[model samples]
Target: MGKKDKKKEKDVGKEIVKDKKKKSKVVKSEDGIPIITAASAIILIGIAIYGYTVYQDLAQVPEMPELDLNVWWGQNTTEPQDTSIRPYRIVFSDAMESEIRWLFEMYRRPNKKKSFEDTAWNYGVHSEAFAQFFSYWIFKYSFIQRPKFLNKFDHFKTNIQGLDIHYIHVKPNVDANTKVLPLLLLHGWPGSVREFYEAIPLLTTKREGYDFVFEVIVPSLPGFVFSEAPARRGLSPHQMAIIMRNLMHRIGHKQYYVQGGDFGHAVGSNIATIFPNDVLGFHTNLPVNFSKLAYLTWVFGSVWPTFVAGEHVDKLYPFADKVKFLLEEFGYMHLQSTKPDTVGIALQDSPAGLAAYVLDKFMIFTDPANKNDPEGGVQKYFTYDKLLDNIMLHWISGSIATSMRLYKECIADAEVEQVFSQIPTPVPTWGLRFKHELAHSPDFVLKWKYPNLVGTTNVDFGGHFAAFERPEEFSSDVFKAVKAFLSFKK
Candidate 1:
């Protein structure tokens, strides 16, 4: 038991302590295996459920409303109806002029009209803009010649669904050997057949390299302009689609292409969705997909936007910012969708108030930046006479109230939309995405809804009113779309 024996004893104790610690670490590692395996199994099961949900949604084909071609919208018809296609004319009758004169006179009165200091359209139509518009309407708007210009395009009316359906039907002035295709052009709120007036000639006439031209038919939606209003309560968007289809059938067209914007987009989309075989192609300026997959893909895009959107990523991403802007912009939609009759009474009564209400929307929609323009830059895209032509049409016909009701009809039944949301049509589609458009869905996202999406044209200008704002570009896109649609595999 000397110094060497003592040193060896200390070394042996240290080894024994280290071995116990190693055994304890091995036991702890073994205990965690089941927890790790259970966690992985849970994650795998969740992933499988998510995949199935997405697949089930993708495979869904929505059940559309069963509508009747014989369903009449007119009220209490006691006699045999005249279904003849008759020529129609727009007249600025003395009686209508007399009614308009007094309304403009009241708008001329100097009153306590004011807006907050330095605030622009953020508060609504700028005060100065409100005055400037009416001044032009009273002094410059030609109620006389504007009607002639609007009538230059041949208009006709025929009884359909017991209502006198008014439409502008134009034939292509091309060679007889060239093909003539039927095109159903549509309009939305605050817009009429007049919106397509500038684009109609372009579409109907010849284009380079294309052998076919569109025999364009633009309709003043039922309850708007010269078209007869529905007598009953059920003229929803789906019903509007039915009316439009019947109009085409009455015009001797079995199938046709469709191009629309705003609520026109809704009706046109419905037509394609319900009768895929009847519509040759669907073209829209405000293209959006309501399918559940579109929503899921959009949320997925937020995390990795490059995967969902490419150059237009900014338009789709920072989702919260877009949500905020939509909530801000949709106040009008909420009002019109819920109680259009309330405000419709005012718009139907006052030409000036109606101009202000619609022009404010035009200003912001043409370019969101115009919301900051104290003078309101609507004149940049349209003429004073042309602007009043649209405003006066609503006023003269007293269709403001009826036209506004369309918004309510469109959103009234959530079930109709819930069913529509699942439909993915085989109809070929095209999207004209403008730079300042309120929202944009890239090609990948659009494919889920429009599987036959042939193309998307990203214009470097304009906003909501494409045909009115940039007719040349809009018409060009329509031509391109029709060409692709014809050649595309069904």
Candidate 2:
């Protein structure tokens, strides 16, 4: 009786264990749905959050404060708005002159062991060229006479956006009945209003083919020279464009034309984009595209040369080589864009350092190949006096640091990409491509970014400093652009 009872108990236990194992297998196969569903839900939520953040970032446009011009000019409430154009002259103090002279005299030359090739400007500013320029600065160049030469143009300072905006206003001495159009000529880095000195007379004088003459107004970009440095940060090119438009308004120019190269191109683009109604037309020598589409456009354009490069396919092709060149040339940009204060302090302290820093850009931008030359090819395009005069403007103003800060302030702005690519300039646009422009984009590439581009001219002689180097060609191209704009309007 005990044996039968033990066997029955064992069989019942085995049946119970087998049933539990079957249920466990079912759970492993079918019960994992909720876990998988939960994981998928978490992944979906993460993606949604990331996409929203990117959209918000891309959609935001930076807001700029509007400045009251009348209040800023220091006019009392009772006094009538002093819109009167007062003549302004550039006068340097004795202390400033002495300081500059001392700095030049005390310049530290490269070590005796340093060869010209070792100090090639392609790597940075060549020591040899800096020595020659320094010699001219100390012995031959006259800062006093330079201002007198600049004074040949009518210079004026007007308060705009709480900053003293200095500009050269040249009117054609034509009959009162002759149609005169206001032209705002903007300059970029390593250049100043001095670049336009030679082109002013050509622009103001009426050409035979063109009926209209340009009343050229070339302003020192804020913080460049006479124009006051921005009191606060975040004064991007967009803000400068606002100040420029206001200046034009204050001068009774409801509508005007604009042209620029380098930083000026960015500022003019902002003007044309933000104030399309006021900017009748726009032109630039250096046209860049910052859109997302540019990547694809560049890729396809590289293979099919004519699509973007046109006849300049040879120059624009071999895109990798261009990238390599850019990487080499972008050291200053990297430094300035990130830690401008570091280099700024060095440049501000030493005139020779400043000359090397500033002149390096002029040399490379004029022609990157010039770096191989011991003189950086400076003598071919720019005279010692002219180059020194340009440097003097930066030296006298002590604006090297402040001007460099623009790169730091504007580079990280979320709006820069949007403004550059998405925002199109609706006004008639023209492009003048010089042979030695630092970054040469073919006319077709330019047209893609500037949809309303009326025409493009590929000039053989000029470079980035086209106005300063080839004033006659620059003036003629400007005349052609203005004529095109007028014709387009008609």
Candidate 3:
């Protein structure tokens, strides 16, 4: 009876094993590869790819390019260069005055295509509002006193690396106890030394609590209004940083603080990254970090903004919305980065055309919300004569083409990332975030590029051109930042 039962149990176990094998066969891939094995292989490959991309942001940095310290950019490089600083005057000759009248006459003519009804700066510097200002610049604005205003600053030119570098040097009138620190104030495109005219007085003045006063040097960057343009290619921001370093050295400054915005931010970042030893401190209103880790952190923090946004969640979260808003303002950036010469011609040909092109930037960069108003609050923030003064300088120089060449240089060479975008600078850094600044970079992300970030000063007003628009507030912010920078150093 036991032998019969054992034989029946063995037959049942064999039937159960055959059924399990049939189900396993159904789970296998078409090529007979196990499903789990195939899934594991794909997952491993993805992890490898992810590591390759993120490693550089975390630790890997590209080698810095070997730049030519004495590279010649001028056409007459063969001749012995004049390195002596010389006094320069911004003149309005009779011939130039006649040209201004001619441009004025040309600009006064009614446009065949009128502005779309009810659209403000949304359609790019409302043609209606712009025309009225253009008329004021021509007839009512005082060109008689404008030159005097621009010339009020101490303007000088010195040849550096075969190019004429124009700058305004203003020293503080202070007591012996006060420390006068050299501060390099760099301005970006659509800006000239004129941008610093208002800030010069305030920056040079002594603050009560601080023992230091800034001896400001505002340079018209090469290819800008008074500075000579390079004759050849390859003058990216890094190269510009070299020129700035040399310029400061030439001015007897071994180490100085740097402050910038826009393309100035790009060049200043490079200076801080490559010439960290020479930069005592750095500051920027448009604080941005372009490293891969910074982007990854930003995206990762999207799920939980408290990780990256800190207290300024509204300004940075909903990454797609921020990106979309940026895209709307970046049309000019794309054009200048790709084909600077083409837009340069459009800007250089007609004074009115240049006004329309750059003033629109003034509208948006000053405050994105400016586009909502008919007048754009441009007049509210800046007086008519001063605004016209800036436009006139651009017109007089016809530098729109060459000044914009920096954009083309930076993108084409891709030198920015190799030099600083992926690299963090140890220089004591401070960020001033204006409520209306074009871009917002919270201190959390900024720390990736600026590991020694001393502090971030957040203001309720102002935008990109902080120094130009709100000199007092901008100066106060600068004072507080420099104090923090000194504290960090100590």
Alpha carbon lDDT of each predicted model:
0.84, 0.78, 0.84
Clashing pairs in 3: none
Candidate 2 worst ten-residue window by lDDT: 67-76
Q: Estimate each model's TM-score.
A: 0.86, 0.82, 0.90
User: Candidate 2 residues 1-490, lDDT tens each?
Assistant: 6999999999999999999988765553265655556677899999999988865544443343343323342223464444556778977678888988777566544354345565566567676677777777788877678778968988998877567788989888898767999999999887899898889999999878777898999998888878878766677777788788889998889999999988898889888877788988997877665554555566677778677777776566778887788888878888888997788889889877788778888888888778887778889888988887887788878888878877877786635635455555668998888887876665555655677888888867667888988899888999998889888861
- Per-residue lDDT for 118-158 in model 1, tens only? 88888888887777877777777777888889899899999
| Candidate 2 stretches greater than 4 Å from native | 1-85, 108-113, 116-120, 303-307, 414-417, 442-444
Which should have the higher TM-score, number 2 or number 3?
3
Better of 1 and 3 by TM-score: 3
> Positional deviation of 444 in candidate 2, in angstroms?
4.2
lDDT of 3 by residue, 16-119 (tens): 99989888767888998889889999999999999887685466767776667888888864667888999988887778878878977876776557778788
Q: Measured by TM-score, how close is model 3 to the native structure?
A: 0.90
> Cα miss at 311, model 3 (Å)?
1.3
What is the descending TM-score order? 3, 1, 2
Judge candidate 1 at residue 305 and give its lDDT. 83
Off by over 4 Å in 1: 1-59
RMSD after CA superposition, every candidate: 7.0, 6.6, 5.8
